[model samples]
Target: MTKVKIASTTDVSSDKVLKTSANGKSVLVAKVGDNYCAIANKCPHFGLPLAKGKFENGVITCPFHGSKFEICTGKNVEWVDSFVGIPLPAIAQKMIAMGKSPTDVANFAVTQEGTDLFIDS
Candidate 1:
């Protein structure tokens, strides 16, 4: 695997996420406590950019469909439960999901060197 420098330590905080590219692949970098985490920047639900989503407590909520994912592990916490930040009914959510099952985003290994952070892509 090749290590690609994605961001600097100052570029991300615990409450914020940085959207960058790793070897031409969209990557989301977040600082969780003292550790750094990196995941695919695209939402698995609709291929939407996760950079515009909300990040809190090591989880990211997709803005378009409200799919929640764990940034560190890229695990799907909730899937397609809302639209444009508004909660949707179960029936409506199912319809909006369009038979697509919940999927986890891709995660990459992050290595920190001084103020710079690199991801194994």
Candidate 2:
């Protein structure tokens, strides 16, 4: 594994995500409280960039399809609910996945060195 320095600690504020690329892979670094988490910047559902997604309480909601993921663990929290308040049938939800199943986003291990942040990609 290669450790790439992506940003300074100050560059990522609490509850905010900083988008950067490491080793040719797009990464999103977020600071939740006192801990820092790093994950792939793309949504697993449709390969959409997650930089525009909403982050709250370590959960990121994809802007395109409303897929929610846990930032720290890269676990799938919710799938294909981007239809806002509208409730869709299970079959419709499955169709929105484009025949793909829900998958976790790729997460990178993050380490802090002084003021710099390094991620293993």
Candidate 3:
């Protein structure tokens, strides 16, 4: 595994996310309590950056399609359930999903050395 330097501990706070790249792959790093997590920055629904989405309680919701994913484990919590910021019906959600199955986002192992943060890529 290659350890790629991402940011300093001070660069990311509990309420903020640090957007960076590791080995040519875009990633978003967040500090949860005293631990740190790194996940793919792109949302699988529309291939858009997830940094603009909402992150809460270890889950990140895709802004475009409202797909919720577990930030730490890269698990899919919910598929497309909304359009933009408006809630959609189940039938509408399925239609908008375009037959795409729910997929988890990619996650990287994060390690902190002193005040520097690193991710394995």
Q: Local distance difference test, per candidate?
A: 0.93, 0.85, 0.87
TM-score, candidate number 3: 0.94
Residues 46-87 of candidate 1: C-alpha lDDT, one tens digit per residue: 899999899999999999999999999999999999999999
- Per-residue alpha-carbon lDDT of candidate 3 for residues 46-115, written as tens digits (9 for 90 to 100): 7888888888887888889999888788899999998887999999999989999999998888898999
lDDT of 3 at 20: 90
Tens-digit lDDT track for model 2 on 42-118?
A: 98887888888888998888887889888888999998975543656887888887888889999987899999999
TM-score of 2: 0.90
Ten-residue stretch with the least lDDT total in model 2: 81-90
TM-scores of the models, in the order given: 0.96, 0.90, 0.94
Question: Which has the higher TM-score value, candidate number 1 or candidate number 3?
Answer: 1
Relative to the unseen true structure, what is the C-alpha lDDT of residue 86 in candidate 1, on a scale of 0 to 100? 95
* Backbone-clash count (model 3): 0
Q: Which stretches of candidate 2 lie over 4 Å from their true place?
A: 84-89
Model 1 scores what on Cα lDDT? 0.93
Q: What is the C-alpha RMSD of each candidate to the true structure, in Å?
A: 0.8, 1.8, 1.1
